[model samples]
Target: MAKMVDQNPLKFSKYIKTYYGISFVEFLNRLKIHYFLTHVDHVDQFTLETYIYQSGFANRSTFYVAFKKYVGVNPSFYLKELKGK
Candidate 1:
């Protein structure tokens, strides 16, 4: 997700130090958001299942759980909102 900040230097940099006291799980959640938004256009469960498998998540269920916890919404909902935009 480093590329997300590289492309939006100012906006991302603002949060660089804000995660200092956060938990590792929270950090992972942040990365998940960046990953989701950056890859929203290419997302497909079969593909994501392959990609996220290596991230220590056994399956989409776990990933979605953490994703919803931090994002306050499911990826499908986020995608729907983006489409409306």
Candidate 2:
């Protein structure tokens, strides 16, 4: 899709930033984070760390940051909140 618009990734990323008010990386990160949130529970995980990597986050910190940014809480807090409900 990006190629159809601009052959250069840098230019296409710039256009995404110009229009979306965020860098393309942010856009992709948010999408990945949301996908993780929706599917994280349904998927079997032998370890939380494994799930984090499988969800497309490079590491736990990156996942935590994105989770906090979008969900307004870190994963641990979010899990606690879920338990309270």
Candidate 3:
């Protein structure tokens, strides 16, 4: 990212931390989670596995941890909530 932006990597990470109040990895994870939630519709257990990788998560456990951290609910329950709305 710093290479792409012509920035020093350390400086760039510092900027992200200051600006976003999160580390660069956290920012990227949040972006990935946001992408998955907004792009997926009609989510199911089988398809959730697919979308986990599609959202750039390496596996279900990591995705579940990140989802629970940021979204405040598991994906399945979140989908159910969305469906209720």
Candidate 4:
């Protein structure tokens, strides 16, 4: 991304922090979470584990941690709530 925009990597990271109020990794995780939420249901299987990998999460632990951190609930609980509605 820095190379694409002609920015230094450190400079780009700082810019992301200053502008978005989060580090680049957090920003990326948020993007992946959003993608998962929006696109997971579109998958034919509809399995959370499958979606977890598809969402660019490295593994279940990482996915659970980031999902809870950003979404304020674990994916299973969140999805259960969505189903209840």
lDDT of 3 by residue, 1-85 (tens): 8999999999999999999999998988899999998877746545778888889999899888889999999987988888888
RMSD of each: 7.9, 2.4, 1.9, 1.6
- Model 2 residue runs over 4 Å out of place are 1-6, 43-45
In angstroms, the error of model 2 at 77 is: 1.0
lDDT, residue 4, candidate 3: 97
Error of 2 at 29 (Å): 1.2
Q: Which ten residues in a row have the lowest lDDT in candidate 2?
A: 39-48
Query: Whole-model lDDT for model 1 versus the true structure?
Result: 0.65
lDDT of each: 0.65, 0.79, 0.88, 0.88
Model 2 lDDT on a 0 to 1 scale? 0.79
Q: Per-residue alpha-carbon lDDT of model 2 for 1-85, expressed as tens digits?
A: 4778656888888888998889887887888888777875654446768778877889999888888887888888876766566
- TM-score of decoy 1: 0.52
Candidate 4: lDDT of 48? 76
C-alpha TM-scores of all predictions: 0.52, 0.77, 0.86, 0.87
Note the clash tally of each candidate: 0, 0, 0, 0
Q: On residues 1-85, what C-alpha lDDT tens digit does candidate 4 reach at each position?
A: 8999999999999999999999999998999899898985565477778888889988999889889999999887887788777
Per-residue lDDT of 1-85 in model 1, one digit per residue for the tens? 4575475644454465465656545676667656665666655555767555645566788778887887789867876887787
Decreasing TM-score order of the candidates: 4, 3, 2, 1
